[model samples]
Target chain A: MSQRPTAAGDPVIVVDRLTKHYRVADKDPGVLGTLRHFVRRKHRVIEAVKSVSFDIAPGEIVGFLGPNGAGKTTTLKMLTGLVHPTAGSVRVAGHDPFRRAARFLEDITLVMGQKQQLIWDLPTLDSLRINAAVYRIPPAEVRPRIDRLAEMLSIGDVLAQPVRKLSLGQRMKAELLAALLHRPSIVFLDEPTLGLDVNAQTAVRAFLREYNAEVGATILLTSHYMADITALCERVLLVHDGALVYDGALADLVERFAPYREVEVELEHPVEREVLAAVAEIDTFEGRVVRWLVPRDALTQVVARALETLPVHDLRVSDPPIEQIIGRLFDGRFEGSAAPPTHPPAA
Target chain B: MRRLARLIGLFWSTAVAGEMEYRVNFALAVLSSAGGLLGALFGLSLFFGDTDRFAGWSWLQALVVLGVFTLLDGLTSTLLVPNLGRIVRHVRMGTLDFVLLKPVDAQLWLSTRDFSPWGLPDVLLGLGLVIWAGVRLSVSPTQALLALVPTVASCVILYSLWFVLATMSIWFVKIHNVTEVLKALVAAGRYPMSAYPAAYRVFFTLVVPVAFLTTVPAETFIGRGQPAWIVGSVLLALLLFAASRAFFRFALRFYTSASS
Candidate 1:
């Protein structure tokens, strides 16, 4: 039912078989080898990104999902033009990023998780002013935009305070404000909600949703947090072992991995282990609760048998969490159920 | 030009604000810089006592070279050196992603983003000695003419030379030790190039360009200037500056930030 194309014109970001490789020296640990390395060092080629390709349409917030070291960051880096690709091509806003033409930089921004762009010793406002000057944004325009972002992010006071003194969440908010000051049409958000408290995460997520909706800024975000993906993106790109395994709606990912619903039962008294075994595949059993993964067809039969034959006080049926589906996909524990295609299906 | 001036101003204020946050460190930095300068001057005074003229040049001329060399050292140590170290760290830690995304030339941004207010004192003291040495040299119009051309060319050559060395770091990630090599070569600039004899002087001028610092400048001010040498040095500086820019662009092709 989904109508997503591999490459589309309305797409803001397009990558075709993009790859990046680095050559690094190698040396043995022996004294002789160490001395020999001084004279002639060995080298190896590391393929960080292996022919990864994807297309992101305008105004779309696509969650780029992958475990650490799975080429997620590499792909993001290539898209943003922070790193050059060894092979293939990437175009954002119809500009080659690695060329780093002023026109290309003006249309995009990248927010790294652990790193910061703010001057460590200066106030956030001062840093923003430098960026403003660099972007050549008129002072009249910069002032009002900064004021509006500060108001929305509730960081007016922190802008005057040195960045070193700001709390982690406050710093992130300021960082986001700094990145967006140019009103870039495309944003590469690398773990933007990382290391943030729940309140702050909610605030950031809210701000992102509002900003994207308001400005139609296309965002390609990479985060391990399922909440971030589920909340912000209609589509999710799953990368595993440096390859794109799945790229579609988030629910498609869930349905592809876990088609069965989990049935959890709370018993008045302890039930025999054999009874649960007969009911379904007993995944885990605690004091008052017994959890089982039964096929969607068997869920009804199992629940009926448990109610008829065993002591069942309460029961709840729910789809597995997106995190669990992702875990299973990466863990190689489950094969593709390959759910029927659906258009903009609920994720 | 306006943007650069504003950026430099803001850079100074922010550097001061940041340093003030660590008050003890700032105080120590000032003290150490002053102490270092005094120690170098004292060492030179002791050496100069044994000789009336070093390689046929008076003590005043040598002092001028030493002062200019110290000023260049201050510039390198307090700004260029520190920023280069930071650039390597930023590359490793992926903070450079933040820099690349900014709407500015990343190379220009990285090179000049850092400053040290303490270095201003060295410039003041160095220029003072140049004037003092000029008075001692009889202040001839010909001497002044010779001095001005070579000194400007020397500064440009030295600055551009360091720029090329620092830009190498973008491609040769393992050359973080390049700073030590640069520092060692800069140390040679402390002595007048003429004192080293003809062969050594030629080597310094062509190979290391240390002659650009003292010998060329001192030659002009000391009334022994050569017209061809001044023109060649200026040509060399322009060529080196252009080469550094080209090298920077070439290295940009290999830069893949950790974020990417």
Candidate 2:
């Protein structure tokens, strides 16, 4: 699954049993509960990230995927030194992230889609200048850095416009420019393309790819969009319930989890459900079309049998959407129904 | 140190540019500041209507305290309120994550990121009143120079107090009103410490330390400052400033960024 040769010197990011626990106050949803809470508060400790461990090589773009509360963002926060892990260890760029030494911070950047650091009332350039000063990029280098990034991001025109006036896509691009102005060696992005139109999402993905290629910066990003992962990352780390469920190539993930393919049949006439069930597991049935979920090994046999016996006008076989496969995986449907094979068959 | 100063200059310049968008607000700010100053002067006059001295200090001496209070209040609006007051919002919105991720010191960034020129009117008027009172008192040049030490110390103490309160928002994310309460108490600085009752003076001196914010500075300005009080004022400012920085670091450990 990992076709790229591992970096020579060492992994840029090392995480061994990294974890975080948060103590959250508990209260019910009534005035009486509020009174009770006020009298004696009760705190429950939640293990947000539970002993998750994975290493990322330099210049590798790894997608962090999970359902809400899966600790992907929490893990990113710890790696970026925004939050301290409760247990285990994480070393990024030869520094303990929790220490957040200046040298360590200079080498890393984090961008969260929903949270913006730009000043709302000011022009995007104003915020960029502040970033420049904070990062101590020499004054002479600031303009060229901004110009280069703005060119890559295609946000040059909007840099002087107030952030509030720019579209969400423009603002996100400007944010990327500011985040990358210092040329960090590692970038942590949480849903960078979130809430953007399709074209904007594509633009941001392209910018990230170009930036990574140009600077050779390691990137770890989490997004709900499967296209983002497929387009940007060859490798992915999937987390569920505060634990690492899978970490491997994107292709391997599809092969291992989605062992079945979808076969769509355009029938000449309607067929009985019982008769169709003999050929394959029926996914959907209508007047003249039938869809079946057939195992990878049995797909050809099932299609042959369906064509021979059934009044088949046409048939096509393709893998299910990755989003659907992952959604079902998290739903625990695949676990009970089509138990994943321990090892992927030889390709 | 030079780098920090440069950064602050950049921060304030950008802040001014950002604020310039609302040019009319500056006019309103000046109007309100003038109204506030006049109201304060009127209130002070009530105490001195019948006598030149109250609480063993002349009216001019008390006006010095009022001037210091106005100066500190202006500084608050200019720096502390605009910057530290947003800590709660940042904590709630999770933008504090960006601050922490920056290579610069988070405390420095948060404490000096904003500047409001609306307070400049109060600052200038306050300085004018202080100098006017000094002229009437025949204050020597050395006394004026010496007075600056405690004035600067008062600014530090005031900043530290505001920062400590703001930093608590990490644990209690809705503590905005708590800072307002501190402001209400610090308003006591408008009068000399001797004007207050014994209990009020004790609370102001020991608990909130409002006495050191204006009264001690005013005493120094009038050339009646005791050496012990001046030393105490500087020491208190340094201690509180250090404590505020330590407190900010401690609070950050508990910062659970708002769940995305």
Candidate 3:
């Protein structure tokens, strides 16, 4: 997709060159350094988020993709006004999140997968009512909105149970419902589907998509689950070591980094390894099947040649999985660092 | 106003429910807390045995002060202690992130997050002693002398003082020791300020106001009512409450949630 300037005016969240550096104390083992450490404490600066920029239009669903410690969570925290950026400008709903003014807080909500906002020992229903009062939503509308969300998420029964007794996925749904009960226009979800089963993950993804459409809420989600990004997000912002590495359409990212589809052929018999190498970089080779990393544009040509020349029996070609592409991208070894494994790569 | 109070009540009940999950631990905790106050009362009795009217305050009057202090201490421990203890860990672990994103004031949330229903025993025992003192010293303690109003007001003031110090955790990230220090100060309230001298009352009533926490309030029931004491206690409580709120907001400026 070509770059298109958003017409949504100034973007709901416009973060430019955001940075966060934490000062951690430095100490050595043994009683000597420990003793002196208290007298003259020394600190080392660790940059957690370094010069990241992104813009999300109204109603945009963007995925923040990266491995752990990639600053995805740091960026989300700054956007939600939960944390301050060391340097840079972050304006969510046209107000500085760090300011944490009542108006700005009212327009946004954040959900953390590993953390919960519900009162742990209370029934979710009680927590929901509390949140309603907290956000000052009209009492008349709270129950209906809550009921609709509960029904849609299939969490109505769980709402009566204590939060501690509910399953992780159940608690997560309740959290999401409570978060949206205030009708926030901008939602920040950090690892919302983590530790959930595949079915629960799918259910959550669907609910999020529906909620965004119904409420016109802009969503920025950070998840290590590539399937989450592949299924729900239109665009993805990739962060690496506290910096924005790539920001564009999810499809475009795969297209750019994984520009080629992988092709694999199962030969009738084990052939000389040179023949497999001659066609393309042999990804893997075992008894009969061999795999090659070939450009998408050259897939047809390579497959045709392999079928004709090599005692070829069967062959297939497909785009590399998002997980493999991402692993290669972070490792910086996608480009000819080593020969691809020789095997019939699964589509 | 009712809605807010009800929300706080629910919060309190939830805390009780969390603790109830472990019945053995909860029973032991209640017993230990009760034992602590029993020990304090026993110590007070021993001291009274030596001098009935030490420092111009009688044995029963001293016990009144001790009773009020135990009640106030129980309230702080059951309601404020657990939550205040968690402030540092919340800041370090980023749990405060969830608290802030909510629509309520961060200070209000932290102050009311946890409550220990087990501490009810202390309140009951304290009330029994206060009534027993009231009956023994009845001497037709007039409507004016019944100091129940000011006594309750003083409890509110003392609790507010603790809230102020606990809220300081928002500013000084390593304020886990602040509440412990406050508890130590409360321990000093068990004895009469008159024994130390008039100067200590002035210091505590003005500087830290620890005296009003128990002594001035207990004095109300013991026919030590003074209009000046009532006015001073209320004014100081309101002033301290306002100052604590301002300090809390000031601390918010430096608060950077974790991983942000």
- What tens digits encode model 3's per-residue C-alpha lDDT throughout A1-347? 42423446558888888899877789988899999898898989889898787788999998988888888887888898777788998989889987788899889999898877787767888888778877887889988999899988989877888889998889899989988888899998999999999999999999999999899999999887888888888887878888776767777667777778888888888899998888888998888988898887788888888877899888888788989888987885556323332111111
Worst 10 residues of 1 chain A by lDDT: A338-347
TM-score of each: 0.87, 0.92, 0.84
lDDT for each residue of candidate 3 in B1-260, tens digit (9 for 90 to 100):
77668778767776776777887876776688678877987877776676677777887788788888777777777777788877776877667887788767777788887787667777777777777876787735573255666666767776677777776665566787777877887887877777567787788767777877888777777777687887777777777778777877666666666543
Candidate 2 displacement at residue A19 in angstroms = 1.7
DockQ of each: 0.53, 0.71, 0.43
Q: Name model 3 segments beyond 4 Å from true.
A: A1-10, A119-123, A137-143, A266-272, A296-304, A307-315, A332-347, B16-52, B59-64, B85-89, B131-153, B164-180, B197-207, B219-231, B250-260
Q: Rank the candidates by TM-score, best first.
A: 2, 1, 3
lDDT of 2 by residue, A1-347 (tens): 43433555678998998889998889987999999999989999999898888788999999999899899999998998889889999999999998889999999999989999888988988888878878889899999988899888888998988899999999999889988989998999999999999999999999999999999999999999999999999888888888787777888778778888899999888888899988888899888888998888888899899988899889899989999879977885555234432321122
Off by over 4 Å in 2: A1-5, A265-278, A285-290, A303-315, A333-347, B21-24
Candidate 3 chain B: worst-modelled 10 consecutive residues by lDDT: B139-148
Quality class of the docking in candidate 1, CAPRI style: medium
TM-score of chain A of each: 0.91, 0.90, 0.89
> Model 3 fnat?
0.49
Candidate 2 per-residue lDDT, tens place, B15-92, comes to 887688898999999999889999999999998889999988898998899899888888878988888667778899
The candidate that wins on DockQ is 2
Q: Which 10-residue span in candidate 2 chain A carries the lowest summed lDDT?
A: A338-347
DockQ of 1: 0.53
True contacts kept of each: 0.68, 0.75, 0.49
